[model samples]
Structures are given as C-alpha cells and as structure tokens.
Target: MALRETDPAEVGGYRIEDRLGSGGMGVVYLARSASGRRLAVKVVHAQYADDDEFRTRFRREVAAARQVSGAFTAPVVDADADASRPWMATLYIPGEDLGTHVRRHGPLPPPQLRELAAGLAEAIRDIHRAGMVHRDLKPANVMLAEDGPRVIDFGISRATELAAADVLTQTGRVMGTPPFMSPEQFSSPQDVGPAADVFSLGSVVAYAATGHGPFDSPSPYETAVRVVDGDAELDGVPPELLPFVQFCLEKHPKSRPSPDELLHLLREGELPDPRPAAAPAPAADAPRAPRARRRRRLLLASALGALLLTAATALTVLAVDSEPAPSAGDLPAGWQEWHKKSKDPNVDEDPIDADGPFSRCAATGRSLVCAGDDVMATRFALADGSNTWARPIDDTPDELGSGDLGTVIAARGGRAYVYGADDRTEGDANPSRYTVQALDADTGKVIWKTVTGDGQEATEPNSEQGYSVAVPEGVVAVYGAKGQQYALLDADTGEVRWKRPLPDPDSRICLLRSAAGNAYLVCQKWTDDNVTGTSFTQLDPADGRPRWTVTVAKDQDVVGQADGRLVVLNTTGTRRTITLINAASHIVTTVRMSEPQPESATPTLLNGTLYVTFPSGSVRAVAPDSGRRLWESNSTVESPGLPIASASHLYLASPSGRLAALNVRTGAVEATLQGRDDGGTADSSAPGAPPTLVGDALYVPYGIRSVYTVDMHTLRA
Candidate 1:
C-alpha cells in the first residue's frame, strides 16, 4: 500500500510512512513514532468530519479499542476523537489480513487453522471483558501476525449493554458483512451481543479452512437469508474441527458457545461430536469401533490445539488468572485477588444513571469504600474484595450535565465520608440538596449526615470539568453558590464547623483544596475585561479567617503542596513548568518539564516525585525540584486513573478494570492484575478510580460497576 498525494505527512506527531488501507470511515497508514516505534494510525475521512453522527461513532470506536488489551488485539496507543480530523494510533502488526492471506496462499494448514481459532477466541474474550462487542468481524479485519492472529478494526463495535439503546440501529441500519453476521444481527440488530462475534468467528474459521465462507452466496441478501434459515455448509471443514465450528455456527445466539466456553472446550479436549447421537449403537456388538475412532479424532484435535495454544500461554495468564504468586514482596496476611459488584443485596434494580460514568474510592486501615453514579457507597475488606455492606445515598437518577454525581470523598479514623445529593423534587430545575454522610467504615452504619453548600454553587467534586474537595485534619470542605462560598464540616460529627463567603465571589472558578492538613480556597479568573490571575487563600479551620493569600498566573494549576510549598503546573506555550511557591517566604522556584505534555495529561505529586500520566498510557516520574526525568514507561492499561503510590510500586487502574503496577524507582511494569468481564458497558472517556493501597493490599474500582482487591505480591511484571 502506498500513500496518495492527498494523504497527510504526519498525524499526532507520528510520521506517516505508507498507506495501509482504507475503509468507509477512515484510512490506516503505517507510521513511526518519535522513538522509532512502528504504528498504524487511522485518520478519519475528511468528508465525514462534519457529520456529528459519524463523529460519535468514531469516538465509540476509539473507546472500544482502548478498552480491549491483550495479545490477540492491536492495543490502542493514542487517539484524539475531539480533533478536527480525528485519528487513532495502534501498535503496528506486520502481517497480511486473513482475507488477503487465504486468497494468496490458499487455505491454512491444520496447525495454523487451530491457531487462528484459538487466537480469535482469545481476542473476542478480551473485547467482551471490556464490555464491548466487535459487531463487525470478518476475514479482512483479522491480521495474521507471526505469534498469532490480531483482531483489528472497531468501527462498528459497541458496548453490549448499549445494544438496545443504540441510535444508529433504530433507523433499521444493518452494518456487517452478511456472510459473517450472526442470525441475531439480522433479526434483531439492537439486541446483538458477544455471541454475535462467536458466530462471525465460526464463519471466519470456515473461510480460512476451506477458502470459502459457509454462508457464501452471490448476493449479500441471499447470503444473509442462508445464514438465518439454512444450515452451515461445513462439508469441507476438517473432521477434527467440524464439531467446534458447527457449535460456533449455531443459528441461535444462545446455542452458540461463549468465547470462554469455546476456549474451555479446546483446553479440556472434549469437543462435542459432530456425528449424530442417534447413530446406531456399536458398543454392544461391534467393540464400539465408532466411539474409539471419534475419541482418536478428539485426541488429535486437542493435541493440535494445545501445541498452538503454547504461544498464547502468557496471554492466558494475563487475561484469566484467578490468582498469581507474589512478585516483589510479601502480600497481606490473607490477601488474594477477589471481585464483587458493589450493588446492595436488597436492591435488585439497576444502578443510578449518569451522563459521564466513573468511580471514586477511599481506603483506611483494612476497609475500602467506593461510590459512583452506578452504585452507592459500598464498603469492602482490603484483604479480600468482599463487601460487608452497601448503602445508597440517593436513589433518584442524576440529571444529565447537572454535576449531581456522588462518590466517597475520604476514609479516615474508621469512618468513610460520602458526598451525595438528594433530589427533593421530581425533575426540578433547581439543583438538588447536597448531603455529606459519615458512615462507620466497618459496619456501614451512618454516623452523621449534614447538608451544606459552597456559595459558589459548583459542580461535582473531583470532576475534571469542575473543582475538587479536600479532607484535611479530620475536616471535610466544600464549595457552593457558584464557587462563591466555602464551608468546613467535622469529619466525625458531620457538623458545619465554619462557613464564609469569599472576598471575590465573582471569580470564574474556585476550588476547595487542602495541603498538609491546611485548608485552602483557590480562585482564578482570566477574562477579556478582567484578568485577575489566580489566588490561593489559606483558611483557618477554627475561625474561617484567611491566614494568607498567594497570587500566581491564571493558568497555573495547583497540583499539591509539600513541605510548606505550594506546587502548581504552568502550561505556557510549549513549556510545562512546575512552580513551587514557599508559603512563609513567598519564594518561587520554577522547573520546566523536559517534554511537552498533552492537554489531557494529569499530574500527580506523590512522595516528593511528580508523576504525569497521559491518555496514551505513558507515565513519567520527574524530580519535583530539579525537573529531571527519573524514568518513563508505558503500560497496557489505557485511560488510566490517578495513580496511587506505595513504597516500591505505583498502581493504576483502567476504566475497563485492568490494573498495572509499575516499579516506582525504575518505571518498569512489575505486575499486572487481569480485568474481569462484568457484562456491562465501560465508559472509556472517563478516568478510572485510583486504587487504594494499604500495606501490601490493593483495592480497585472498575468503572462504575464493581470493586476488586488483589495482593500486590501476586502481580508479576
């Protein structure tokens, strides 16, 4: 494939070398990164740039690709759905597509066929675990890499739970290759699920094995009709694989085996017999000759599957391991990998709904609490993922774009502070009454509840679009009245300690944050008429008096304060400067970052080191004082959350439930905990909840669905 004159020379800093191919949505180009790593970048077609619906679908495609990470899939490296010309970059897999290969080299041999089956199964498994379904799976979409097959192209893929609610399908649009589509896809496109991919896998395997699809016909309409009403033409399929292929090609989605079940069958060497069970009995008088021959064929198939599966052993461990050995140090006394939905046992209904979905968590001692729009504040043991109790603060659904989302703010002294809202009126335009509840961490009992509002009338706390809350010295702080007011409440009693209006209530934005047990009100305004810069006001916890006020540039964002110095990030032009302002002396020290950061990059200051995580899955640890790059490493987890640090490792979680542990000193990934398949949609655009690190135990929340715990020792690099 060669690049055309119309193609761009570069995309997102990746140098485009050659064109890989083109599709209805975009063109994929072979590119190279700054570090000389090869990549495949898909640039959306220009004609569809202005199409709002098309952009939405493209965003969904990037989300799906980022959610799925495994050996049998091309992991997403970078993407920008909001760009003028949206594009995504994935690791380059140099191999011909299955369709091209079969056409040039004819049908694959038994060994390669066996490998393809298992690889596709693994790829589908990973996608489903991320709560997505690759609605379009065909020969042209699968790459035959040297190690195994890699699933590519997520243009038409979508989350399973969104199937029924998909807007595109409402117009009766059917979007997949007819021969590879499942019956349910044709009969009920909105209800298709992971089983649909299994059906496509079966068709793909049949094509690879015999150079033709089982449901092939002259017209796509005829082929689709055959797929829905006719039996598969498995006449040419290898005898050893006939049973498995037939099982996958079942007309009913429910009858088709799941990806896990297919893998299990291959592993157990007990594929169903293709021969009819009503065959004349031969055991009584014929020495069971037919049964013996069938057993031999099954054994041969199993042997082939096992031999090909050897290449995927590492991937299997990374994807489906129930438990793993300790890698770096000793784990907690009884710690093990465990997962549980945060739903209350008494509540059989669905979790609360929200426009943007994510989770928040806090941990203290041996207890962890997580809350989200999907579920209420749920308490779990740090040693295991078992929840002792679950409490919902507000059952009413949050309005879209209302900033009414709730979450666990902090956990301290055997109590968890939860920030939530109670909707007093049905669909009222006025904002809901915000409430903060202090619950006993061990028993999930409400200790105290208080209602307060910051004069600023702000949005959700910890939201990227809004400001964040801080729990300092056993006191909880919040803003209200559009960021014009501030309040502090006692952690144990949930009683308002002090409330006050800010000196400048008309500031553009005001953040209630704290550092080193001291409460601070940060406000900033940079407008055409009034550029007030930014002000940091330290407030007295006892009397609501401003102890001191520090002013900096309007663009400087406070990351944290350390050793009586306020640390802020200043992005001016191409330089990312970390400025440290001494609280007492008012001395400022500026350290310019070595590399430019993306707009989506988030900086976290932990234990004297400033760690910056990007949307591309890259993490960099820098010396706060000197701006020296300590180390940099890229993990498989995409759209990672804020990182939590231990003595030796930095742990991060992805919205799809994947967790990665990087060595803090060397920046090498030391261990990875496999994600779980919760059979629900994952919002990849939202950052995941940071993991709670307590001793050698780690508790993590998977999007808005469930919480899991793992022993740090059980993770291997």
Candidate 2:
C-alpha cells in the first residue's frame, strides 16, 4: 500500500515533517534529529511487522550503515529495528538522485563523467575499509548534491558477519531490482561480497553516461534473464570508458576491476565520453561546401602539428643515450648486484628497438622477468639479474595488421600466465582471440593452454572478445566474453583437478575467499554495450553449488577487499561515484569526488593514498578515505604502465625509455634513469603494458624492444 502524507507525525522522538518517498518495503519521511539536523527516516510497512527475518535483516542494515557512514554516504543518525514498525534514519541529503538528474537534464558531459568515476572510487574505498557491502546500488539511490554525489539507502546492505549466518531467506528468491542485479546474485547470494557492489557501480555508470542501463529489458523477469544470460548493450557507452566498463562487466566477477583499477583507468583518460550522436548525413549534392572543406583542411593541419610535436618530444627523450651503471657500493642491504647482455639477438633490426630503449628489469625469486616490444616473459634467475636460464618468445610485428604478443606476465604456483591475443583483419568477424598459456616458471615449458569459448572466438576484435586470467585460491580463473571458467590444477603436476563454467556469458566475475574457508563468486551482467546491472553468487569450492545471491548496480567495478567488505568504483564515466557493499547485510554507502581529474591519469591506492598518473607524466595522490589531495607532481615523464611503488619510492616508466623514481612518502623525484637508446620505434597502434616491480628491482619494457633493470637501492643510495 502506498503511504499517505499524514501517516505519522512523530516516531521515536523525531517529528516527521513531510513524506519523502515510498517503496514496497517502507515509506521514507523527512525528519529532524534532536541536534536539529535534517534526516530521511524510513519506516517498515505495517504488514511486515511480524516478519522476524526481515526485522533482523533491517537491524543488520542499520548496523552496516552506522559502520560505513562517512564523507560519501548519509550517516546513520538513529534506528529502532525492534520497534513495531522497524524504523531507520540517515542524514537527509538535499540533492537529486542520478536518475532524477539524468531524467531532468539528459546525459552528463564528459567532465562530469570523469569526476563521477574519481569520486565514486574514493567513496567505495572508504566503505570497504569499514567492513560493509552495499548490495543494492542504483541511480535512484545516488544524490547529486552541490558538494558531490552522495550515496544513500542502506535498506538491503550486509556485513561479513550477517552474510555468514544461516540462510534466513528462501533460495532463488530475488532480493533486488532486476535491472541492477548481478549474475551471481541469481545463482548465489550468501557468498556475494564487495565484488558484487562493483558490478552495480558499472551499471549505474552506464545509466549515467547514455541515459540508459546496460541492460534494458521489457520486463523485470526479462531483465533478470538477460542479466544472467546476455551481454551488456554498450552501444551508447563512450569509447573511452568502454574498456574499463567492459573489464568491470566481465562475466566473471573476479576478473572485474577493483575501485583502484577503475580510478586508474579514469585518471588515465582511458574511458572516453560517448561521441556526440552522429550528425545526420548531408545530402549528396548539397552545394560544393567550400567553407566546410576549408575547415577540414585547417583541422587536419592542426592535428598533424600536434602529433609531430609529441613525436619530436618523445624522440628527444630517447636520444639522451645510456649512462654508466652505478657501483655496488651505492646500493642498500639485501640488494644483490648483477647485470647481463640482452638475450634478444638482432637488437639493431628488432622492431622494439626502433621505438627507443628498454628502461628496467625485475627479479622475481628465481626468475628474471623483462619487458620488450610487444612481449614480456620470465627467465630463470635467483634474486639477481643472472639468468638461471633464458627463454625467448617471438615479438609481435609493429604493423596495423600484425598479431599482438602477450605483454603482462604473472608468475604463481610454479607457472607463468601470459595474457595476449592473436590480432586479426579489420573486417574479420573475429579479429582477435584471447588466449592464456601456463608455462613452467622454472623451465619455461608450456604446461597447459586454454582459449576462450567458441562464441567469444567468433566475435570481432572490437566487439567483446578477450579474456583475463588470475590465480586465486590455488585455481586458474579465466574470464572471457562468454563467462568465467576455472581449472583447478595440481600445483606441481599442472594436472586439472576440476573445471566449472559460470552462469552467464556477459557476467563479470571476481573471486573472493573469506576467512571462513568459503569461496564466493561475484558476477555482474552486461549487454552488448553499457553496464546495466550486477549480481553475486557464493560457490562451495568443494563442489561448485549455488549459495546466496545479492544484487548491486547496473554497472560497477570491484576495487578491493578489506575487513570483509568489498570496495567498488561506480561511475557513468562522466560522473564518478564510489560505493561500499556489505556482503553480510546488503547495505550500501556512496560518495562522489568534488571534481573530475583529467582522464589521462591512472589511479593507485597505497597505504590509504590514491595515486593517479596522467599521460602527460603528471601524478596526483589523493586520500579517497578523506577526500583530499595528498600530493601532485608533474615532473616525471609518463609511460603506458601502471605506477610501481616500493617502500620509499613511486616509479613511472615512459615509452621513450626513461624511468623516473619519486619518494613515496614525499612524492618527490628521487632519481631518473636514461635507459638504453636502442633507436626502436614505439607501437603507437597498440595498447602499451604497465611496468612490473619485484623485490628491489623495477622492470620496464618500452616501444617494443629490450628490457631494463634498475636497482632501486642504487638509485636512492
């Protein structure tokens, strides 16, 4: 039943001023606390007064809200969960939800989207720190106030403790709005934690960007089905935000990015706003348009000049030449000394050499991992640069039509996982195929190989067609266009122990293992384009079976896990927001950044500090938890890789072959390494890899050829 304006004049010493809103669960009223602060108070429906289960859940929500209240969320002022009609109150935010804003003013501009992403990421980080998860996140719940986006509504939130309790709700009974449900939510809820919130953030961002959810279905049932079975409809999503959104909407939740990763992507300007709706085609013979022709010529010349200037600057940096190696006496303790010649023969003719030089190297236990043009792999070593053994892989050609060699390498469980795709023709229906190869970390022997589903392989490159792999809980989790698949293998023999297929092809998955020895599968759904919704499921690793499920947003990115809560980065790409979801209580809290930073920068979180690196080599560190900029520096040259951090410094590598190290605590440039000038040209046509750090060494691959190793201690000493 709908609530009437005169329903209640007072409740729990707080006089109700006016009716705010009404929903199936309860009615919200505008109220004032004893301290004179305005608040939004929600009272449960009379019919549910006898539902002990729901009352308990509501209590859990109240607890969660109190735990995670902060800059980005409406703080919980008071609550009477045990009252005849359970009631809860939160600070009243005087602003419009994103839905109302978009409805009233179409889609947000590009700058708004960037700001939204940054703000949302910080908010999510805060909630995660407090150990809560907001299971139900949507545009209607986000307030676009003057200060920033403020996330409200914690009616269906959960904490880690509540999530672990015995099932109080029926199985397969949907608990959230279908339009914003994650795939895992349909299959499992008890296990759904912070990652589930990320899926919701992605959906919310999609709705903000193009004024439509990633999944817009005819009916709630249909939406749920589509969310659990189809792809994100990303047609109207901006190209710049596409990759990041896609990563967030991966069918496998584990593969979804964390708030930090999404912040980085946003800062890097990787997510572009949707191009203005294509202008109507001109008439075939609409006069010989001389003015239009002149404008086009002028624009082309300006663009060319800018490109040339950029190229010239990059070349100038590369021409600085190599410097003599620093002596061992200048290094720190436990930092061994070593050096070696490039195993890559034909250095002069190498395609990577044409771009510039290799800047750094990394020693991972007994492996010396290096980066080269379009290639990165591991070589046998032992804490030093000395090669226990060397294994070489063919590099991709520097041509538009050439195949791309995998660039990211992660070594775990005695095997190295290489992420790459075989490039294809432009018009080819399937232009790229993502593959994961497991090689013996010690011998570089191919242990096993797995390709994405046939449907993914059949899709075109520009379409949803790639996979990401991560090792979680002793299992090789592979996320692809079709869904998440895993191969539990023997750590030593590489023999497959078990395999399981996820529920949806378009679901983004993230693997979260709780302290209770339970494994949760977080999955978010997507359409062909936008991130419409998210869902989470818990699976018993012993035998993959559905547990409980929770729904988050239409679009969101899982940022990180802390104290049992999942941090999520929510954005429409044009307007960023961060939300925290309590896996146990199903409560959500959101906060937005004051303004959007440039998209050219990527964000990173270290010891509570958020660092964003821009394409122009500028790096800014912000305190998302506190909503303040810790430091900003533009002195270092930018690179394609993510920022690498050590105990004392933050390092960034430029494609032009320079490694800049900054003091971590002070954000000061401590040293600069003018890497080897191999005279190699960069593959401007392809995506670049991020730098890798292992032990005291930094490994960087630039322009396509060669790998360089720089001693952090030596540089500092």
Candidate 3:
C-alpha cells in the first residue's frame, strides 16, 4: 500500500509514512511520532467520521483497547475523536496477517499451526477476561507480529454489562466476516459471549492449517446459514487436529471449548517436547524494522519522551515510566504517604481513571478529606498528614465512569459528605430502589441518603455534570433530578425539603452559581443525543418553594449566572454563541464572538466573564454579556484541564501536574509551577481532572496517590 494524494500527511501529530491498508471503516497507515515510535494509525474515513454513531463506536474502541494489556496485544498509544478527522494510534508491530501468510506461503506445518492456535487462544482469553467480547475475530484481524499473534481491531467489541455501552451488537445486525462468525452471532448477537471468539479462533486455525475456510460458501447469506446449521468441511485439516477443530466449530456456542481448554488441547501432546515460550513467528517478507535500531529504541525508552512533549500525555509515556521513588524528604510540610488496606489492582478499572481521580483533598477547616483510585475515601489531619481514617471503595468501582466523570466530595462543619449509592439490600438491579448517599467524610460512615422516585436515571451528584449541592449556614441544599423526580434534600439530615416531578426524562438539573447568588436551578433537556433546550427555575431551599421559572431555546447551555442574569452558551453545532437571558423578563440576547470558537473547549464562568481552555493550551477570556474577547494567552503547558476561577486569578493544571495561573481580566500569565512526571497507569481519557482551588491554596492531585498544594498568595505577576 502507498500514500495517496487525498490522505492527510499527518494526524494528531503523527506523520504518515505509508498506507498499510484500507477497509470499510478507515485507512490504516504506518506513522511515526516525533519520538520515532513506529505506530499503526487508523484514520476513520470522512464519510464515517461524520456519523455520530461511528464516532461513538470509535471512542468505545479506544476505550476497549485500553482495557487490555498483555504481551500478545498491540497497546493503544494515542487517540483523538474530537480531531477533524478522528484517528487512533497503537504500537506498530511489523508483521503480516495470518490469512495473508497462508495465502502466499500455503498451509502451516503442525508445529507452527499449534503455536498459532495457542497464541490466538491466549489473545482471546485476555480480551474475554477484560469483560468484553471481540465480536469480529477473523483471519484478517489476527496480525502475526514479531511478539506473537496480536489481536487487532476492537471496532466491534462490547463489554458484558452492555445495557448502556454497546448498541451495535445488541441490535443483532450482521457484523464480522460471515464464514468466520459464530452461529450464536447470527441468532443472538447481543448475548454472543466470550465463547463466540473461541469459535472464530477454530475457524481461523483451520484456515491456516488448510488453505480454505471450514464452511466455504458462494455467498455471505449462505455462509451465515451454514454457520448456524452446517457442519465444517474439514477435509484438508490435519487428522490429528480435525477433532479439536470440529469441536470448536460446533453449531452451538456452548458446545465450543473455552480458550484455556483449546490452549491445553493444542499445546499438550501436539508438541513432543516442551516448547520454549513462543516468540513472534518469523515469516518471509514480513514488514520489519531494522533489528539494530529497534534494540537501541528499546534501551532509550526513558529518554525518548522529550520528543513527545507536544501533548501533555500523548502518554508522553512520562505517565508510563516511573521516576525515582519519592521519599519522606520530598513530602510537603506535613504530608505523609498512606495506602488503603485493600490492594490496588494491577490495572485500573478505566484508562483515564488515575490511581486517584479526585486525588486532591477538600480542606474541612481542620482536616482534609479525599477520594482517589486506591483509597476510596480518606481523611487526614492537615497538621501532620496522619491518617485519621481510611476507606477503600469496591475493588472494581461499580460505575465505570466513576473517576472519569466528575466525582463529588465536600466536607464542612466537621462533617464530610461524599457522593455514592446505597443499595436497598434487595439486589442492585432496580434503579428505583437505589438511594444516593451522603456519607460522613471522616469515617466513611453513611450520614444521610436520599431516595428518588422510580429511580428513573442513575443519581448524578451536585458535582459538575448536571447537579450541585450547597451547604449554606449548616443545611445542605442539593439540586438534581433523576427520571421524572427532583428533590431539594437536606444533605446533612437526609430529609427532603421539597420534591417534584420534572418535565423530561433526559433533562439534567444544574444549580448555577454566580457572584450575585446561588439560588437558580437550570434544567437542560437532551433529545436524540442533542441538547435541545434549557429552563431556569429559581427557588428557596429554606422553604423548597419556587421563585420563578423560564425557558430558553434548545441550543442554549447555561454557563453561569452573571449580573443577576443567566449567561448561557448556544451550542447548536459547529458554530457556538453566548446568550444572556434575564431570568425574570425571559428576554434573550446573543453575545457575538470576537474570535473563532475552539473545538471542544472547556468553558468556566467567573464573576461576569468566561474563560475557555483548549487542548492546545490556549486560554481566552470573554465578556459574558457582550461575548467580547478581552485577552488570549498562549501557554507553554501543552495539555491543560478545565480552568477554575478564583477572585482575580484563573487556574489550570496539566497532566504532569503543572499548574498555571493567569489574570482573569487580562489573561496574562501570573505564575507557573512545574509538576512531577509520576508514571500513571494506562488510560485513554483526558490527562486528568483539573486541580481544585480552595480558599488561598491550589491542590494538585496525582495518579501515584499524592496531593501537592501551593499557596496562591506566593504567585506573583
């Protein structure tokens, strides 16, 4: 394959070298990073890139690739769905597909055939153990890399608890190659469990051993039918392995042996003597990097990261490499290291989920309460960092996005309130029976919890996404709705001050805060995956009574309250505008943009101004009412999280924990602090959550389970 004139020269910073192949979905290209790391970059076809569903599947594919990590699999290196032409990169293994090899070289001898079966079986086992099924495992998807058969292409893979994640397989539309597809895939694609891959592996091994498919048909339709009710044509398969292949190609999915069983069958007496660990199968004319260069690159893994500095984590793999172990000498004034009683898993639940998502602690007057990857919730004395109490969450967090999505933990008045769910002991199946708990932050004890109506949707906290909780004078007021239910709960006492039915099932109730006041609840509706409209409902928590309610256009998103008016951003599509709406008069005015809007910019409103941070590290300030750009600062930090505003300063953090501050009015850099490049676990999501600014201190959390705070007063312009 060669480069075409239409293909872009580069994608997401990786320079395209040559086209590896093109398929129905995208084109795979040989690419190299600035660090000289060879990669297989797949750029989705323009037609599919425009389809939202395709983008989602690609996002899921990146997520699925992160869940797996083994010597047998090609690890995902980088991906950006938000890019104009969405692309993903994985470590490049120079090799040919198993099918391509058999086609050019003919059938494999028994010894190599046995190794192929073992490698493919192991690859399937790794995917299955990750609680996912690689629905499309055909000869074409199996790459005979130098390190063994690396299972590639997870574009159609889905996890086991897929009521929410995957809709493609659940719909049961025909996917994957007809001949290699399992029988169950034809009838119950949604429920085609891990065993489905085993059946495909049998067919693949048979094809490699013989020269043709077990169920060869003139058409895909006939091939699918034969897959359900037909026997295999195993004439050319080696006699010694025919029975095993037949067992794998069973009409019933259950009849097929598991990956482990198949591995045992192939590796047992098939080898006269114990075989040393099988390395990558060497095939003539396979794509190969120079051995000398490859060896040198392996030795320079640590120092090679300087070339990857463009992205805070492209993993820069500064996240993947460990620095010298931190000692007490490196600990802050009173900080000390502590671990949860429960052990940290070898791999995190999700890629973006750091060892601690909200690694930063919330200062509760005298003590600090926090939640993280290893320690579910813990408290320590600010004076000495002595562990007051520590609580470890479930080994595998109940919610997969628990860390990626904003996590809420607020501590005040000597009582800490953490967001979580409390099952009614009647099984966790019914969402209606579930209650959102406000636990005592200090001891991990349940202090108060609120039960919603019919449990229509999962409980989202007073955190960023849709809802918020505020403790004014001792009573906590929570604003959020689940299903058709909304509640103003006493977060401390667990009492419902007011409850009412919401308008839409897809609406998210957000409590907007501003310098003026924090008494407004903004509910935004989503229809067909699009934010349709927003309604502002002002209320009093003391009486749980409504003050007034107003509705705005479908495209508007309430950023915050400004000068006694609701400041919203109209996100209709590619073009976005800021809209200011009067909560009382219901008058709407659109603020004109002084500059082009950045793609996927995270916006935060402070006082009467809005600050936008782009992935490229550009910060912009705009007047909320006028939509006028005040100033824009090009930052040195390549990747930054969402910016949070303090009185006169705007603060943002990089993946490496670098913190930057700028003047809210001028958008000029005031101060910058370098962060430690602590090696973090492999994750595909954004670098990490933004650092939290509380009172006069900025707290930066890390994946290695530590928090470093700096005094804002020390930063000088």
Best by TM-score: 1
Worst 10 residues of 2 by lDDT: 312-321
Scored by lDDT, model 1 comes in at: 0.65
Q: Candidate 1 or 2, higher TM-score?
A: 1
Q: Which of candidates 2 and 3 reaches a greater lDDT?
A: 3
RMSD of each: 19.8, 18.4, 16.3
Better by TM-score, candidate 3 or 1: 1
lDDT of 3 by residue, 1-717 (tens): 878899888889899999999886688999999999999998887765555655676677678778888777777899998777788888888888988999999998987887787888888889888777888898888898766788887766777666232323223233566678776555434456887788898899899988888887654423543565456878878887886687677654545677777777776633223322222232432222112211121112211111111111111000000111123123234443322221232133332224334433565544566654434456655435455565443223333122222233455665665444322222533232223455564455767755543342333342332333443522233334333345656656767777655443323423333223345555555443334566777666666466777777664445666776777664322224677777668677776777645333556676567777666678888887777789999765655756666778888777666778888878788889876654353232234545555455556654454556666667552
lDDT of 2 by residue, 519-593 (tens): 445454545434456665555555556566667775444444334444554322221444556666756666675
C-alpha lDDT score of every prediction, in listed order: 0.65, 0.54, 0.57
* Number of colliding residue pairs in each model: 18, 129, 7
Q: What lDDT tens digits, residue by residue, belong to model 1 across residues 431-545?
A: 4455667778788887987665432133233322223344554444445644345667776677777778755433344555666656666665545223347677777777778
TM-score per prediction, in order, is 0.52, 0.45, 0.50
Model 3 residue-pair collision total = 7
